[model samples]
Target chain A: GESVGLHLPTLSVQEGDNSIINCAYSNSASDYFIWYKQESGKGPQFIIDIRSNMDKRQGQRVTVLLNKTVKHLSLQIAATQPGDSAVYFCAENRDGATNKLIFGTGTLLAVQP
Target chain B: EAGVTQFPSHSVIEKGQTVTLRCDPISGHDNLYWYRRVMGKEIKFLLHFVKESKQDESGMPNNRFLAERTGGTYSTLKVQPAELEDSGVYFCASSQLTGSNTEAFFGQGTRLTVV
Candidate 1:
C-alpha cells in the first residue's frame, strides 16, 4: 500500500541526482502554493510551501520556485533517494477563499539505483 | 499531538448501497476539509467545515453526498445510493487557520470501492 496511484506522469532519476517536478496553475488570485508527497495508501503530506510574495523558498534539501507571472511552480529535490520515491503534488490556494487546496495531478518520482 | 485520523482504511460496497466515512481532526484545529481522488484524477475538494458550521460546500458533487460535523470535533461523510463514480480515495485534512494557506495535516485516506 505504499503506492499513491499507478497512473501519474513519472520521472525517473538516478540516485544522488537532482530531481525537478513542475506544475501549472490556472488561478491568478492564488497567493500561496504548497508541495506535497503522497506515498502508497496514505494522504498527501506537506513538503514545502511558498507564498506569492516570494519567488523562491528553500527548505531542508528542498526548494520551491514560484513564477507568478507565468503561474508556474516547481519543486527541486537536492538528491534523489529510494525513500524519495513518491507521488508529488502541487496545490494552490487563493486568499479570501475557503482554505481548501486545489491539487494538481501528481507526478511520481522513481529513483533508479 | 496526534494528527488527523480516519476510520475504515478500506471499504468495498455494492452500487446503490450506503457508505459512511469518518474523520477526527487534530485536537485544536478549527478548519476541516474533505477531498477525494477518483480513479486517475487529481484530488479535488469536497467541502470545508469551521467549527459546527459548514464553511463551504461548493465542491460537493451532488445531493447524494452528505457531510456533517455535528460537534465540530469529528466529521462524517455519507454517500447514499452510491454510484460507481463515487469510488475513490477520501482524504480528510485539518488546519489551524482559515483564509491563510498554512500547512494542512492529512489523514491516511479511506479507499472506497464500488462494484
Candidate 2:
C-alpha cells in the first residue's frame, strides 16, 4: 500500500535553535499535505498545510516546503521553544479521497531548554 | 468556540466486555470523523460521517465495531466483545466542510484499555 513516511523517528534540539522535520510520500496522486502537533495526552493539533500546487507556505514561526518532483515535504520551525516538544506528524490527502487524511509515522521533537 | 469533545477520558475493561465511546463535534459542523492510534502506530481512520449519513466506513476494522450518528449532531462508537487489540486512543474530529481545504478540529480523545 502507498503510504507516507518520515525520515527521522526522533529529533533533539536546543531551545533557541531551529528544527526541521521531513516526510516522504509514495503516492504521487496526493494533492494536499498537513503538519500536526500532538502533545502528551492530547489529540493532534493542526499546525500548517500546503497544497501540491504551491511549493512553500508559511504560518507564524512554521514553514512547510513541498517538493513535488521528489514527493517530499519538510516543516521548519524557528527558535524552538519548550512547548515545541511533541510528536509531529505529516499527513497527505489522497487525490480522490475527500476528507480522508493519511498520516505518516511521526517524529518526536525534544526541545531542551 | 468549543472544539470537538469526547466522553470518558479513559476506560479499562476486561476482554469480551462491551464499551461505548461518545463524541460531540463542534456546533454546525456537518463532517465528523473517527480515528484510532494504537501504542506505536500512526493514527488510522475508522470512519467518516457527513451529517446523519455515513459517508465512508471503509476503514472500519471489523463487524465488532459499529458507529452511529443519529441526529447529525453527536456520534457514538460501540465495540462489542472487545479484544485486547481494541485498546487504543479513539479520537473524534469535525470539520465544517468535507474537503482537504478545510481544517478538522480534534477532541481530547478517549483512551480505551481492554484488560
TM-score of chain A for the candidates in order shown: 0.92, 0.90
Candidate that scores best on DockQ: 1
Looking at candidate 1 chain A, the ten consecutive residues that score lowest on lDDT are A1-10
Task: Please provide, for model 1 over B26-72, each residue's C-alpha lDDT reduced to its tens digit, 9 standing for 90 to 100.
Answer: 99998999999898589999999998899999899999999999989
| Each prediction's number of clashing residue pairs | 2, 0
**lDDT tens digits by residue: candidate 1, A1-113:** 53244568999999999999999999998888999999988889999988899999999989999998999999999987889998999999875456788999999899998
lDDT of 2 by residue, A15-99 (tens): 9999999999889988889999998778899999998899999999999999999999999999999999999999898833447
Give the lowest summed-lDDT range of ten residues in model 2 chain B: B96-105
* Sliding window of 10 residues with minimal summed lDDT for model 1 chain B: B95-104
The Cα RMSD across the true interface for model 1 is 2.2
